[model samples]
Target: MADITHRRVRTNGIWMHIAEKGDGPLALLIHGFPEIWSTWKHQIHRLAEHGYRVVAPDMRGYGDSDCPADPASYTILHLVGDLVGLIDALGQDQAYVVGHDWGAEVAWHLCLLRPDKVKALVNLSVPYRPRSPQSKPVEYMAEKFGDGFYITQFQEPGRAEKSFAKYDCLTVLKKFLLVNGPDLLAAPRGIEIIDFLETPDSWPSWTTEEELQYKAEKFRSSGFTGALNYYRAMDRNWELLGPWQGAKITVPTKLITGDKDVGFQSFGTKSYIESEFLKGLVPGLQVLVIDGHHFIQQERAELVSAEILSFFGKRSGN
Candidate 1:
């Protein structure tokens, strides 16, 4: 076991609980929606052993962090600013950043908006989707692919949050962690697994019962509202990025996704992601495909950690 310490720092008017280990070459890890600092448990010890300072924070609304009632506070710009504030609070000028899901979206924006604060970036699952200058989100999706069911569902005001809040929120979150196809045939309840069923390749190796219980307990610690606020900020984030629409990120960047990640096939974004998003990157950029689902860090922690360590090692040396 690594020497781990839990601490809190004030950022963006809220206190964020962060877990830190090791002491050289700072590597800041950010977890996505429905997850807390514990999500990076596997990577924290391993990365620290490899001579990197690992800092994982309960991003604003989850875990022991302060949960702001205002939905607007969860916007991408605010999230990015929160991370910048975190770095300042830590007294570091810049650090290599790694994020998954919503965290990845914020990491990408952080690199673009505060390039001086990010030495390198590793984003899992979600790829960089550049906003167009005069394109309405609906029109943009229609031009690239039709419907965009996920975004549409998320943009449906309070529908998703309310539904999940009413239903078994923990179960819904567990279904997403399934890297393979839905176990619908075995599950007692016949609820259809959405993202996991659609993109089986993105699923990571199955987590142990202990691990699953740990994550489930965390979700129960705080109701779904804080996590769901991330979804509620879609339009707000869109408006926030209006000024930086079409701006390319010029930094050391790497995008990692599961081969069966539903996000790639999501609304025909695979082609657009490869052709447009990846191509728009101005500096060092690379895409990696791993055998896992959206939560690759939790499922395939060794592989994810190795890839990130290699990327940061080479970049830091240069």
Candidate 2:
């Protein structure tokens, strides 16, 4: 692994800490919620070795980045703008953008908002879901799957945050990383990991002691407020993106989802995403299914990097 240098870049009224390595065509990598720039550790060195400048940032509230108090500050548009500003700060006109989870949401918005700033896009775990004019996020979820219990929990301001704080964020993190289909099915009323965090001893064997500690310690540095804020900005993001609801993204786009990941199956949006989101909204888009869960980038780093490199290389004619 190559040494990663850390630098602070000012964006969206906060100083974001970015880890960068190598030098070739610039590649901007953004990490999702509960993860910092370190999430791209494996890819940074690998991409750098493959002759690309890899830059990964701890967005807004993660790692060494500044955490703002207001939840509205964490809106998707704001997050995406911070990334665009980071690119300007680095003096790059545009770069190949790759992101996972919430980072994927930002990447999608960036491509939609400013196509010139993005050479190509690689999104993992989360697919592009265009907002409908008549549908509220909660209502949309409920219409499809009766009740969106997860989004409902997040709608509560401090409930999930308090639960994560109580468990020291380890219990929820462990369950998120390791829970399988059988465990999910065995639970009677849908397994809410936040509810289970109240008792850490009941945490399953999916994550080892060391892995749990690593995540817990990272959250300890800033607590769960910053991460939770991302969820809190749903309404604000919808408001900001009202003008872009029906916009079609023209950039080269690649969507990667983990096969076993519950996100695709959540409210049964997998087929909807393929038929509606990608094919319907974005033009010239490709989808890739990998074997894993939500944290596919971390679980399958080399494969993810290869896919990203291949997509960007082909687009760049390299």
Query: Which candidate tops TM-score?
Result: 2
TM-score of each: 0.84, 0.87
lDDT, candidate 2, 94-172, per-residue tens: 9899989889988989998989999899889887878767766755544554322555556567766765665646666
lDDT for 178 (candidate 1): 60
Candidate 1 segments whose C-alpha is farther than 4 A from its true place: 136-151, 155-158, 182-205, 314-318
Model 1 C-alpha lDDT per residue in residues 273-301, reported as the tens digit of each score: 56744676644578888776667887778
Model 1, C-alpha of 107: deviation from truth (Å): 0.3
Which candidate achieves the best lDDT against the true structure?
A: 2
Candidate 2, clashing residue pairs?
none
lDDT of 2: 0.76
User: Cα deviation in Å at residue 59, candidate 1?
Assistant: 0.8
